[model samples]
Target: MQIYNEFELIARLTHGLTTRPDVALGVGDDCALLDIGSDSQLLATCDSQVEGVHFTLRTSTPEQIGRKALAVNLSDIAAMGGVPRFALISLVIPPRFSQEALEGIYRGLRQEAERHQVAIVGGNIAGAGQGKQLMLDITLLGTVRRGQAITRGGAQIGDVLCVTGSLGDSAAGLFTLLHPDGTGAENALTFVQARHRTPVPRVAEGRVLSAFGPAVVTAMLDISDGLSGDLQHLCERSGVGARVFAEHLPLTEEMQAIAARVGKDPLDWALHGGEDYELLFTLRPEKAREVIEAVQAQTGTRITRIGEIIPSGMCLIAPSGTEQPLQVRSWDHLH
Candidate 1:
């Protein structure tokens, strides 16, 4: 469904779910309610997962889909250097799907929520008609102390660009599922599948970055789309461009193995293959190692300084030393 059919119902029913005294005004209202704290800042982010678009029933379990639905949004919150505290879920399912599948989805959501110490404040559910696709939508609400939140627009030229975890694994994993010739690369495929099914948000890394200081973050973004696309966002938001040294990209052995077997460009997969759910961010030169080390120790995720933010003319300078304007060629729903 296009969401138009139930738009009115969604609006009409939201008000009765609960009334928060802190909410100045909510639902059917021009804006959401909130009693902004003098010392705290609020953050909100939403993500949507569709059956065929984001995942297919062929390779995904209900729990995997469910966990992914929430993890992706939580990753946004983490990118902002905020602690996710609550969530609102909206699930659309076909009538014929088993109750067990639905519950498994919830189980997955709950598993991530518990792991992240977040509470499911509220949500809505609905049934899709026959032949309709399934979808999961979630809005995660988080909070951070005032002046502590990071943003995409703060990246500065000369700032070192970093990623919290290895790249291309998620993309490689998707490849494995699509082409099972790599099945015997047992360890490799499993790693990729896990990355696809349940990505680890760099929440702790975000927090550690916050403690080190402010404006230390010149720019910040999460890599849900692909590396190339997400860098576009950071560059666009910060009004600056970048150069990713392809050789410097931290690739997992599994990713390399898969890429070699398929004759796929590992660097292309690293640069454009999406859904890594890792953080692509930039920080001041002086604080790079300190913050990278801090975040790695705390998050147990490798933090690689792959390149530097630069002026607009050279969007991305590859390791082969070729310069080309970067494009957002990754996942865009309407595409």
Candidate 2:
């Protein structure tokens, strides 16, 4: 076998690939360039799905894998309150999977692409060695009206911290899948499967946030990492802080029951479990109701106020009145 270096191969292909008009220089050079509307902003996001690290061959169908690969990137765009317009997918498929499976992956990709209305521009594909694992790396390109895209650094003091849907259901569901011995496997597994396999990107909610006006809704982020980790990111980015009320946390019933069965802390998972794909944003005191209503009407996504921003840095206050300095969770890559 010819053992070509990875970077060498990438350079060769990057320089040689054919390109379209929108792709200013395609690949190669220091960076890839593209043309954009005079009044629009370019929104870009990247997501990498590994064979075993992110999914297992035994549990995941290739179709699910492909859809999820793109879904995550779409979630990023949604977090930024941007509208996705196109996508490019890179593939590293091993020989073990039949051609049918590979085609299935593409089928899933197309389905999701159509649903999101994102065009499949083009991408590179490579065949992995017999012993190597398959991988999918996706990059989604999106656009938003000029000055309309949101960022993590917009939250202000006294803003409300709101989230979409119940928390820890995904974590509880994961527990049920991994440990069927848990009594509530029936209750929790379904939610976990949906969370893991096909996370719903909050695109509509994001746009609604923009429409509600930036003065009302300042900071915005998606919970790809756990709530605690992501909230911390938003705070740091905005130079603000948060105080969460445990009693106010909108955790599902399944989460509480399953947490007890598995002897896990429901609060911890609610704070720290990753892959929930929910949006967490800070809204002004006056705009909270209007923002929530507007987003609900426009996107059918529920919004709940779990906490509020404070000058006291990030702190978590339990329902039982237990107060503690909120230490950072370990789910983040930064810490």
Candidate 3:
């Protein structure tokens, strides 16, 4: 059998793929050129998924892995309330990896790209030595109307803190897969596993929040690195403090059940559980209800007011009305 070179692989994957008008130059170039036009500001972000670190083939399929690698980057664009337009995907392949698996990864990537109107413009692939792990990296480009992109630093002291959809499902999903012992119900197992395998980016909801003009969303970020840790990022950037109401956290019934069965705190999953991909944002105190109603009516995505941005440091407010300092217990590269 004749082995394919990098150019051949690129042609096979990108052939017959759709292209956007703004993408002036695409694959087969040293660098992709994009014509962003006069009305939109560019948005760029990158995320990586590794074989052992992010996933194992034992638990996830090649398609799921590819879809997730792209989804996470889309979540970043969504956090800024932008529309994704193009992507550049990079891969580090083990020598023994099959072309079938490569096809599956591109299939998954195409699935997500088609959904979000994003085009896969360019990327690179490389081979690795024995025992080296597989890795997938994605660099996504997006755009937002000029003077409209939201950031983590704009939150005000009295803004109401909110999150879209439920939290902790992703963490519960990962835990159920990693530790099957004491896990109850096959249906519940599937629910959580599907969540971990295919997390949805809140692209529509983010656009809704951002479309109400600049003042609607005070600050925004996607919860890829756990709510507690990412919230601290927003707080630190805004030079503010925050208080989360523990009781108000939105936890799914399945997540709560799984936590109870495993003797784990659902709040912990909701607070420190990473990879949720839900939007964590703040709105002016008086406009909170109005915006929440509009979001629910338009997107059908649940929005919860879990807390408020304060003046100095972050904490979690217990149901008993006691306040405790919130810690960064989410994933960190180094201890």
Ranking of predictions according to TM-score: 3, 1, 2
Better of 1 and 3 by lDDT: 3
lDDT of 2 by residue, 103-170 (tens): 88899899889888999999999988774677888888887666666678788888989998777766
lDDT of each: 0.79, 0.76, 0.85
- Against the hidden reference, what TM-scores do the models get? 0.87, 0.85, 0.88
What's model 2's overall lDDT? Answer: 0.76
Instruction: Name the weakest run of 10 consecutive residues (lDDT summed) in model 3.
Output: 24-33
Q: Considering summed lDDT, which 10 consecutive residues are worst modelled in model 2?
A: 24-33
Q: Write the per-residue lDDT of candidate 3 for residues 206-288, one digit (tens) a residue.
A: 88887865586888888987999889878876889999999999998899899999999999999999999999999998888
Model 1 lDDT tens row, 77-126: 77877788999999888876788988988999999999999999898988
Model 1: per-residue Cα lDDT at residue 254: 86
lDDT of model 3 at position 4: 64
The TM-score that candidate 2 achieves is: 0.85
Quote the positional error of residue 94 for candidate 3 in Å.
1.1
lDDT of 1: 0.79
Q: For model 1, what is the error of residue 97's alpha carbon versus the real structure, in angstroms, after optimal superposition?
A: 1.3
Clashing pairs in 3: none
